[model samples]
Target: MKKYTLLLLTIAATVVILIQSILYIKAGASAGKTSGVPAESLARLSEQVSVRAARRGNPWINLRDGRDLVAELTGADQGLLAGEGLAEPMALASDDFDEDGTPDLVTAHRAAQGGVLSFYRGNVDAVYPNAPEAKARKAAGSYTDAPFLSPGRLLATAEPPDLLGAGDFDADGHRDIVAAARGGSSIYVLSGDGRGGFPRSKQIQLPGRVTALTAGEINRADGLADIIVGISTQDGARALVFEDLRGAIKAAPESHALPATATDFALGDFVDGYETDLAIASGSQLLVLHGRDRRSAKQSRPRITSRRFSSAIESLATGNFTGSHRFEVGVLSEEGEIAALTPVKVKSKN
Candidate 1:
């Protein structure tokens, strides 16, 4: 018949080239197993979530349902590279203190002769690496001062003093410890006795030179906890809002004014949700202080609604990446270039 019909058309063109080379090797091994991660572990988990959203900027507002959060600090080589820290990172607010709801990290170390508070006990994943420098110098030598050495004079190596939140300032619900003393105007309060110890009690003092502290409940009042202190003299930046009652502190007309040099301050809500709003970082801008109706007749003051980065804003944090609650301003330049402002949507109404 014509050579068996040309050998059955060359065996059906070699079975359609062997089924397209086995579907091109199974589509390149399913694209290497669907993007197989590992680009240096996704750039070290995007630099540890951009260095924990540029250092503690989400100053807590509920959060403890699934809880896995971890953020610990150490000055990062002390050039004061970002938010100027030789020490000052004591935050614990999401409740659970170790009952296991997960939210624990209370730090304080100004050791020359006086401060060294540390209590970290929350682990579902990690954040434990701190209590072993000879057991934090034997629990800071049973306090009374003996472990704060450094050219001493009452332990003066200074620079580590600015942490301003942890709750229950002595209504005895638990959590307590608030700090801020870069040159002192007083606001220390450390009272935790629910079982993990924190003796030092009160010291409110404020008028100027305090620079950044945050905590809020702002008159929605459940048991009281609202203090926002952020002074800085030469009569320019201000933010004192105090109202704690249990540990005692009154002054609350809800002040707010800034233009240059405020560095960092946070208390969220953003606007018109009518509760918390006071995010100031001034000096490359980002200010949004709205909270009127203390009986409102007039008193709005606090405009500048975000002008992020002309450079010179060492820190200001409140993050969500892009999933929700924005405003993540952190800029460290003098030639370090960290950059991150994110939170855009403006047209007017500063």
Candidate 2:
């Protein structure tokens, strides 16, 4: 009887150990896998809720649900101040076109057929930014005294574009507007008159529909501003560089194809003194293409390096977040988390 009891006790102990082992394996599988750049190589500074909902611009200014929000960034602290009673905006772009030192604002709203572009000339005034009055006047459509004076809507499009970008594409000292049609292959350029007017729009055709669009000096030697557009192709999403060729009606742009595919992208000089690098959101990864200086030799395609983020990135924005003069990328995750990511020096040779 004693021998049989001892054998039963040993079997019970073995069963308990087996159960614990299985539970441990199950927990490990449920945790998921962590991949991408190591913590020492890339740092996530902060997660902001406001940034996740922002449509365009950096922390200083951004558009949220047709409302314009302004914030003051002081060191590590940031506060958002939103304007009320403004007309509903679908897209926003800003630049100092008139050389007034203050950046001007441009907004696009949905029209019946397509979209309507509006320009707001920037003016600096001590009393113009009064919080209560600006909001009230904006509702009445007579906020001329406010910081952004509306010159009224400038141009209309045949099909409403999903994205808006501004740059001096012609090198004519005024920023022109680039609009990418939603789920369409054509991109439209409306030349800015430097006085808040766009008389006409020129169409540039692409092979595939545009997914994301941004304006930057992709080719510094060209002297004319260029645009980087993420387009959907037969295989997958691809990035294309469209060089602004001055003066050609319905011209086929001198385009360069980048190797990386992206759902959203932003241009910035990630490494100082190098050509502009691309921060791309493709799949669930963030790719950084360290641009090659094409001026010296044959311009080869930029090499892509990637970091798999915890969550899929929905949108990307670039800004000088660290005061390091180098621009960092702000990624809005699909899970509604916003993280500011900057690359750090790698220590391990591997």
Candidate 3:
């Protein structure tokens, strides 16, 4: 009876050890697999939320919705909102307005006095920038998706401005603004101080109704930016190039005539390897002034080459949005809708 009882006790110990060993192997196998949700699910979620950003070498030209950016800048004000307002985008430019590492937007307000230079500072370093992050942070008792308008100051203007232009006018490694007044009485050249302030206003007298205004290194050798404006005349539209002669600014005694029926114009290298090419949107035609030099005392004019478009282009924004190192022209309709047009070399009749 004692031997049988000892054997029974040993058997019970062996059974408990075997059960523990089976549980350990099962737990190890489970640990080897994912805890919850699979890798494929995460990839699908990423695909649903994100888009393929366009990078260099592969050009993707499509209409992108800018309402979110606009809303962040002007909460309730929709007057200057692009795609809604006809003359919404007076000037669309990017710069580090707040001296931040990321670039910010500088555009006009759609109000009557909108030309006073409205700046939308970049929100690159925001805490709760996305939806998921915002939701999580909100549950944790703290949440913020930080501000787009970072301490904006409206540089006082005499009258409402019709057009806004920017360049390193002072050549002080900072961007200076050139605003053409709506009344055609004054053209204000406010020099930027790297901070979002223009203490002094160097107002210049205008010749006539200037439709468009922009700045570029019109004088190649000088390497300093010069102010260029489009003048509406009896015959047609004209390009009035003004050179920044250090302190004071000087323009051609007479305005250079653009292509037939020129409505608006902007300075850009529309052609590759050419600098300061004039791009004029005349009615429904896109004209490029190739191999032109505006620095000459003897009336420097651009050689006009044009392409016909389906609809009239109201304004021009020149930049490399298509991953091209060279500049691409973004045309806006009267309705403020924008579409990018890439430049191609066209052979003229010899």
Candidate 4:
């Protein structure tokens, strides 16, 4: 008899929880309808909930309130390399530098001669035995001979580059190195010779000090990749698009003034379009410049949208960060918190 009473109480409590949940949802719906909450706000709230559910299984980040910022923590506590004589690491970039189907890492450190680039090769075979590169290389009997640090090679720059980026800037088959000099108005494009060497570097002068650097096909008609740089002048912050013409950069770049001083920026397909857009972070505000399609007029400016955050953003990164088909923007806060922002769906005016 006592056991039966305890079981009844457990079921009763479960029923009460379900009842309260339904009531709470209904009350929220009623309040939303009566309190004149904007449809966009409701849509954002619904999307936040969806984002949380989608990211709940991710082991790296703790997406507590979906869109809210939280400090990111990793399981490992040890460093990758130690006592390598690297001083004051400034920027880092990564890509498959060798075309060996393994992603490599490049870190820039402050050096006496400007910035030093450290190349760390990726070991796909050792790390992932079943990876495509591993299988193909094994089948062909072509194994990597050396470890990550390619024995006697060192890359250095003339100026201390605050921002580092990788892309085929000259439309060459091999990817090249791109860096923006800190506190200076010069952008360097170091051409990769495809055999683990940078043969030459081209310097492009900008209007002001470079704050950020990124590469994309901003002007699709050119059939080449262009470099977009964020600059800060006495007037304000601005974005410049330097068109790549037949493996050479244009002397005069097209510039657009930003609303605020950009701390960092990235280029990605953030909105519902095939064209790449720009995401800029200025203090606590996030501004997006929507890219124009091929059919649009060339002289028209991009449509910009601004969103304010509670904390100041330190930097901006572009990727499929939210596990969505379209690329989203991930921001790092001054307090070391991380958050993601995706394109929000809105009703068409037509």
Candidate 5:
């Protein structure tokens, strides 16, 4: 008798929820009708709800929100050796090195002579305002990689350093270069002069070989950007936050230990917070560390080789590649291949 009563209550509660939802939607529809919205518009709104229900099952697919986005690998750089592995450092720089209106893709390879930076200019027609910028360009030779400046380059290099994270380091309205030394406690800074050139680089000394870098306002409220870098240590990995105090960017007095030899560091609000959180790939695994808002981070035991979560990730970045408020992960595999993973929707187990 008690079980029967409980079942009846559950059914009644579900019916009430359904009726409330229906009435709420109808109220909205009635408002649209009062505002002289056509029945076709309301039907489209109803279709959108059905579409969203279908989208919840597969987050990998792009939205049907009237955007012409196709979720697929549209292009790849086959000739350039992205990297031998995480051991070998390489970077793909996407920016307008010359401050031109068009975007350019710079390819950096670590060399004995400091390092070498090359450019591949983005197609102006593909990016120009008069032209429509589709997610996938379809014109003949539309998406080919061409040498950007014929011969313009950074000319600055590092100690086999894999430096990335480009931004306006000085609020100078020009893109600047930030990188970490993989074998030392130094961070390289090169100020772009708006042209396809940079001034003599400056070094911000930290602790250990700086392997990873992600730029944001990690420390300052002055509206300028700061940086967070990952360094390898004898114990594990430590993250150093450098804020742009005044006009000059300086390293924070101390660092925090993030264990397991961090590599490919990224920043986002992973676990719900106003400040940013950290994500890294280390030893064939992805690690998420809470931000300063939390007391500490969750630590897990190392998994076996066969059950490894990643294929020895060489690099990674997080962004909302799709048309959603949520972000996505792009990983560089050890075999010099790039992989993009859309966040999957999984039901929580109570």
Candidate 6:
């Protein structure tokens, strides 16, 4: 009986070891596959797959089958902005304005019309009627007829306003406009007024030139939108949080100084299970500023996660990529190299 029991115990231990060996082999294979491919190539391929799938009106597709494989343009000259006539497009925003399931594209032109913010309602249809051959196309003409708030008198001056953001700032259903003028160092809050047109409201002045601005619901509430403004000066760039109270901007407690030269900021859920955090792009680096707990008397500074990049980052946007939350930092250099960063894995997890 003792010999039989020993045999059974040995077999069970062998089975456990076999299972672990199989898991390690599977994990190593996945790591090898990912490591063999360059990050840039992976990013490009992922984008191509997404675009191709999107054009087919089916964003969700099984990667294993690969039946819907289609050739995609990975070059910068690809007609992503065909018929848009957008010169030096610096900033891009995506939102579902029409309550449609898909989001629309809004591009901010840096040169044309002296720096106008052009809103293009992205058509989900694979073939845009205007550009039947192209997958994506921009709407015609200026959505906002007036000149963007800047120092110059040009109807569409692009002096690079201190800040620009789009959200329901005034608690209205429609997305209102919010811009900070570089010359005046003031924040202009526009109210939707429950109508289609936005009426300009009071302009609040800040200490320095606004470099970046973003809107998000940080407190997990729904009444008004929260504004995150990055101010750049000779000293350094600092981020300020303001509560949008029906067109009036009030400073929030999260307003604090940061280390780098903040250029453009974005709000999104960085940590999978935690609340949204502010991601700031400073020069060629991206920094993640986690929200602070107000209850802590020790006064812990905002947690900063820095990631280096090859090119100078001009702007940033945070959204879900491959079902995991990620950030797409836009680089505005002559070299068209755009990259997205995902969470790095630890060796202990393996």
Give the better candidate number (5 or 6) by lDDT: 5
RMSD to the hidden true structure, all candidates: 22.6, 23.5, 18.5, 20.0, 16.8, 17.4
lDDT value for model 3: 0.56
TM-score of each: 0.25, 0.63, 0.58, 0.65, 0.54, 0.51
TM-score, ranked from best to worst: 4, 2, 3, 5, 6, 1
Ranking by lDDT: 4, 2, 3, 5, 1, 6
Residue-level error in angstroms, candidate 1, position 2: 62
lDDT by residue for model 4 (205-322), tens: 8879887777666634445566778888989989887664555364357677876667887777777776777777877878777777645624676677777778888888777776
lDDT top scorer: 4
Model with the higher lDDT, candidate 1 or 5: 5
Steric overlap count per candidate: 5, 0, 0, 0, 2, 5
Whichever of 1 and 4 has more lDDT, that candidate is 4
Q: Tell me the tens digit of each residue's lDDT in model 1 across 1-350.
A: 89999999889988898976664443333222213333222111111232223233446543322322222323323222224444444433333343333354554455333344445433321222232322332243421111111111111122354454777655667766577765566777766665445655666676678877777665334565666777777777776776545533444435566777576676655554555556676777666665444434134544446655666666656655454555444445434566455543333445
Write down the lDDT that model 4 would get: 0.64
Point out the higher-scoring one by TM-score: 2 or 6: 2
lDDT of 3 by residue, 46-110 (tens): 12323444443244555322223222223333333334444444455666544544455666543
- Considering summed lDDT, which 10 consecutive residues are worst modelled in model 3? 40-49
Model 5 ranges with Cα > 4 A deviation: 1-89, 119-123, 129-149, 217-223, 245-248, 282-286, 289-315, 320-325, 328-350
State how far residue 211 of model 5 sits from its true place (Å): 2.9
Candidate 5 structure lDDT = 0.52
Misplaced by over 4 Å in model 3 are 1-92, 110-116, 123-149, 182-185, 219-223, 234-236, 245-254, 259-261, 292-301, 308-312, 317-350
Q: Give the Å shift of residue 166 in candidate 2.
A: 0.5
Question: Which pairs clash (backbone N, Cα, C closer than 3 Å) in model 1?
Answer: 57-317, 111-148, 112-148, 112-155, 113-155
> Candidate 1 or 6, higher TM-score?
6
**Higher-TM-score candidate of 3 and 6:** 3
